[model samples]
Target chain A: MTESSKRSRQVTFVRFALAVALAGTAGIAWMSFDLGIWDQSGPGPGFLPFVEAIGLGLIVLAGLPAYRASSDLLLMPANVTSILGQAAVVAAFAILMPYFGFVAAAWGIVIATAWLNGERNWLAMLLLGGGCAFGIQYLFAMLGTTL
Target chain B: MSTTEALLHGLMLALQPENLMWGFIGCFLGNFVGVLPGLGSSGAIAILLPVTAILPPTPAIIMLTGIFYGSNYGGTITTVLLNIPGEAATAITALDGNPMAKAGRAGAALGIAAIGSFVGGSIATVLLAFGAPSLAKLGLMMGPAERCALMIFALCLLAMLLGRKAASGMAAALLGLLIASVGIDPVMGMPRFTFGQPELLDGINFVAAVMGLFGMSEVFVALEQRLVGKITENVGPIMPTREDLRVSVKPILRGTVIGSLIGMIPGTNSALASFLAYGVETSVAKDPSRFGKGAIEGVASPETANNAFANANFIPLLALGIPGTASLAILMGGMMMYGLAPGPFLFRDNPDIVWAVIASMFVGNLILLILNLPLASMWIQMLRVRYSLLAPVIVLFTLVGSYSISSSMVSVWTTLTFGIIGFGMKKFDLPIAPMVLTMVLGPLLEANLRRALTISRGDFSVFFNHPISAVILVAAALVLTFLVLRLIFARSRTPSFDSED
Candidate 1:
């Protein structure tokens, strides 16, 4: 594999590993806080969740050996930057959703995302992004499904 | 009771002006996406799924189904003319097709493919019309234990077929199962993996996951390549010679049969079917050396198999209400959203709708045959457009498509996250299809397994107690064993399959 490819894989493995670890820890911690005893039915509310978290953790742990043997990190810096940038775009829209309502939020998301994708032409972005938002809003409103 | 009566009733529903128009529109849109690589039936269906939420169930499903198979037919165009496959299923077409194109026989290759697809699709649709109810009845006889075993068999088969490394496939499948275990436990109605996030209480949306894994990942890869240039090449005439037709007939027939059978198997995808058909035709050829060098049979078999499998893949969904692939999974969601169940009873309860849908396939195939010939030249023109223009549009749609699924920005983020992961996996030569298949099947396998165990008083051996379940389990075990043995043997020798991706 190319160096960049190898780095990309490592980054992914590390991110997944961290997510798994955090999930497992949270699950275990949550179980102790509430629901003093595990419920009798098949599995309690926390039982499967904790089990899943631990399972994910173990899988991630197992991957470390493979990662070490492979001679490459799982992710590249550019990849990380892109992933983080994409996440920030979504987060911005999400934080604005309640204040802006669905139309504003949707339009904002479409335009922001399109620009992030490298379409900097203001008119083109608005035409494509704003038009899509309007079209979707119209369709959803007609269907009576809450946006 | 009569065929004429059935046909008339189906035509009545299918030929309604609105329905007919939607069918044409669906076919047209489907062909457009299919001509583009990195887009497939599921993405097309997902993008339009919101539209279906507004329309009547029957017409909505009919249009969506038209798009599904229509895209399959359209995919072969790129594979034959350019060396690029529009979908993985069309990859085999490129083997001989590119050679033929270079030989200035592009017209013949495309013509043979179109004819072969029509013949294959028509046969499979006929089989589906007559045999669906019977197969569904057979499926109904299977209990939860059998279903679980069947799912296991499917996972095993898919791993063997698609995975570069069996261990990694198993790990990926296990991770899918882990992911599926999120949300509230189905039996207890208690949240499991929400981590106190209200949004996660409903669990990760399948649509988001799919969009991320397949669609977003594709965009990331495109970006990484910094691809901004147009790719256009001169394509020759649009008609096949009489000799070309004669040479292609047998392979088309062979591929059609092979693809239909493979498509019936739950986890065997069209790509594998096409590959297998190509391998078979080449091996059995009188002159094997001619196989990759513009052999007409090579083009004929994969194209025929690809379309045949696309049609036959509907069998599992219709019979057991279980989706055998990603696209079918979306169809299942569509059916449920329409408040129409897809199991054995659907056939008896909704014959007119069912038969009309089947009948529409016949019409759709004919439409595609006519449309593809004239449109081939135009589609080739699309390839001339630069990636810089296409990339932004694809990115815009990907974001919009992911967001539209739940109106949740989290889903959009998930798409980008998974896209990067997908790009990484691609770089490492990991097979993404297995991950996709597992992601789709994970929850079904878990739900059925849990249901079977609960029904049998937690007796784990219920899986083995049933005859069908036992047989499927044994088959899965045997396949696993064979794969392990093959790996060991290969490692000890030349390590022929070491190159991943």
Candidate 2:
């Protein structure tokens, strides 16, 4: 695809994201108002949120037209893989920590992350991951703090 | 107690073995992250913020502050050896530091930088010791109206002065305010945007947001930029001559003054301070052209300036409850986590903790200088650590940090969700610092404004009636006008002007 076309796609994606965010903010504002938003002395619960949501929504709308230009914002293929890989690892680590415990989950994350990013030797990965993970666990443990 | 007496008391507390150990660990890690790319003091602090969730506030604050200044000091290693700056503060050092290294005076260049940082740090800390108390005394006189105005002024000035585009910065600030309003409203005991989730009633965890924004987002950017740096094996002459000291002395003093003053302001940071110091050094030099060609002053001036700026940033944070820079904003978050707010009252309410933190810094700077000189050769090995290997480890730590906050999965989910949002914001060229700072300050702004209104019996004119509040609001209005004009000018110049960062 042309670079300009790639940029247009990214911009459209961004605009769509902004729209969703605006809608979320607006929905929240609506709900806050529904909760009964008036008091004698000053603004109530919904008052500030409503004003803030409108400001953000307007600003997001104002930022929309700027995406209409040719630009170089598309991520390269390798970077996309690397970013997505790391992100997925983070999400998985967050999920696995409850079941596996912090230290074990950490070790797993380290190994998985290292291997994903090209630490080929499984033994080395285990050593490095185990060493770092357990080291922190021990350090915090000694300090009487838990992960 | 007098400043001198309080500092003496603080010294006794900081000397405890456990506190000393934390400081040493922070310094060592500071050097490690400083030599490596991607993570700076702010990132390290965020990733480690949860660790502080369990410790006493004093030691935690000391350790984190040590890590912060130490990282800035550590950043000098790569700049002199390999021309890679760890963060903005050290970028100025690279201009002449790399040339000096190539000229085979790498040790001398590195040595003077250490000296400059130490000198700058000590000077700034001394100023902080004397400065904070006086500033706090003034703050003690302010009513709620004035405090509210001051905070708004701080945020407005920060948004206006710090960014390339004022409108985007303001938008980011507004977004932060909106995000901060997600939980229960403190005044009315009403939930605004919690979506019926009990987890959010307390609000978005600061550590989670910090992890996602500064920590995870950094990983994404580093990956995109393909930043894998190599350490130079041979760093020449690790010590400076008496002649080199003579060359650097004046520049260090000049930088210290410039950096300290800039740091006192609400928005300027060490990066700008270093650049300004370098510019001043070059312009005032007897031989202007000697710069960018291994001039020792080039390294000394900016290095000194940045360390001074880093130390001085705490002045605003401590005295006025305003964070002057991004890292300090995170530090303010750390302060909040400790159940300590950074207002004038903090000085009176938490004198021991505050003074001990200040005293620990003096010790931390000494320890950094004392250790870093011999450890320069050792720190270069840190360069061999690749960003790829580091990225996953950071994610693991970030997960632990997010979970450690509330011991809940919701915090983890919040982090990952914002991690994705932060990634997108970064890729799209938006500045996250403004957003993060505003989020932290936004609730305070709303709370204070409401409190004042409640006092005034619903008079909207109450804000404009008070002199201090009126001036601050007027200043905000002027800043807004500037943003409007800037938008108009840019729009006239280009078809799509207002949309960018």
Candidate 3:
């Protein structure tokens, strides 16, 4: 794709992301209002949240003009894959932690991240992963908190 | 206790072998993190905050403070040898430092930075010791209305200074307030945005949020960039020539003055001190053209300014419970997690913690000076390590650290979720510091605002009725108006790039 087209795609993505944020803020504002903003004594619990959410929505709307004028692009597709893949590995670590336990789950995280980082040496990755996993276990054991 | 008496007592406590050892470990770990390209002082501190949970409050804070300043010294090593600054403040150091390295004067450059750092840091510590007590006294006089106004001043200034645009910064700060409201409401006991998770009652763990935002996100960026550095220049003698020192003395003193003044200002970047110092040095030079060509004064000024800025930033944090920078904000979070409230009461209630931390700064700077002078090459060798090898270890550390916060999957999930959010924030050019700072200060702001309102029977003018609060609120308004006008004029001229003026 051409540079201008890439720029347009980036702008569209940012606008969509920002629109979602605005909607979320508006929803929170409504919820906070429903909860009550004031009581007999003074400002209630929802007062701060309601004020902040409303302020945020206004700020986002004000910033839109500057956003339109700016030429910056948010994400380059080439780099996004690497970041997303690594994020996925971390997500999987949280998922697998209960079933596989700390050692196995942590070991998978180390190995997968290292592999994704382009460390092609299998034996090296395995040794590093195993060492880190056991080392963490020993640390927690020393601290009297079993992982 | 008197300031002198308290300081002497604190020095004795800092000299204890256990506290000293923790301080040393903090310096070592901080230097290690600062020597690397991607991981910064904030990330390292966030990831290691949980480990401090196992220790006593004094030693834990001593260690964390050591990390804060030690990283400043370590950043000079990469800037001198690899031209890759290990921290944002060190970016100014690379302008002349890299050129000096290419000219075979890497040792002189590094040596000057070390001496400048030592001198600047020592002077700033002395100033902080004398300054913080008086500042805390002033803080003690503040009522809730005044305190709320001060925080408002800080938040508004931070939103304007930290982000590329005031609106973005204001948006981020508001979002932080919303995040802070996620737990059970302190007043009404109603959940704001908890989604019915029992774990949300205690609120989102600050350490988990920071580790995910700064530490894990950094690793993700590193994996994408794949940064690697090779040492090409030999570090000659680890001492500057007498001539070099003679010329650097003035800059060092000037830089210290510049840094010490800037550091106490809430919401200003420590990096701003370094950049200002460099600019001052260049503008005052006999031959300003020699700056980018490897001027010794160039290396000396920013190095000294940054170290001074690092130490001097403690004044605001220790005295008024306000953090001046992102790393200091994390340090404040760590202090709260340890059940220590930082403010005027801290000096009155916990003089031992306050004074010992101050004394430890002196000791940590001495240790860093010794370490950097003779063992500069050891740090340079660290540059040869690849980012690929470090990324996995960092991820594991962050994950385990998050899990250890509550020993549950909830904190870990928080970490992962914030990590992704942090990445998007970075890409979208939103400032993360304002978000983190507001999140840390949100409860205080809310509580104070409510108390003032209640005291006044819901009269919002109570804030304007108090002299201190009125002055501070007016100042905040002026600052906001100035920033908005400046933004309007600047945006009209050109389309700026991300995170830059």
Which candidate has the highest lDDT of all? Answer: 3
lDDT digits (tens) for residues B401-481 of candidate 2: 787788788888888888877777766666667777878887887888788888987777888888878987898788767
Q: Which tens-of-lDDT digit does each residue in B1-501 have in candidate 3?
A: 777888899999999999999999888777776676755677768877787778899999999988877777777887788777655677888999988888889999999999999888988998889999999999999999998999999887775564355667677778888898888887667787777888888788888998988888777767667666667556677799999999999999999999888888876776778888999999999999999989999999989998888888889888998887778888999999888878888988888899999999999999888888888888877677666777788899899989988888888889988887777777676777778888889988888898999899899999999999999999999988877777767755532211211
lDDT of 1 by residue, B1-501 (tens): 554566567767888888787777778777776766556666566555544545677787788787787777666766776576655677778888888888877777887888898899988887776667678778778887887888788877766664445655555555566566567666667676577988877777766676666666666665554434323354677777888888888899999999899888877777777888898998889999998788989988988888888788777767766566667766666776576777666776877777788778888888888877766777767766545445545554666566766666787777766666666666655655556555556666666766786677667788888998999899999988877777667634421211111
Comparing to the true complex, what docking class would candidate 1 get?
acceptable
lDDT scores of the candidates, listed in order: 0.68, 0.78, 0.83
Clashing pairs in 2: B107-B237, B107-B238
TM (chain A), candidate 1: 0.62
Of 1 and 3, the candidate ranking higher by lDDT: 3
Q: After superposing candidate 2 on the true structure, give the runs of residues whose Cα lies further than 4 Å from its correct spot.
A: A35-38, A70-78, A145-147, B102-105, B482-501
lDDT for B279 in candidate 1 is 88
TM-score per prediction, in order, is 0.84, 0.92, 0.96
Candidate 3 interface RMSD value: 1.5
Order by lDDT, highest first: 3, 2, 1
TM-score of 2: 0.92
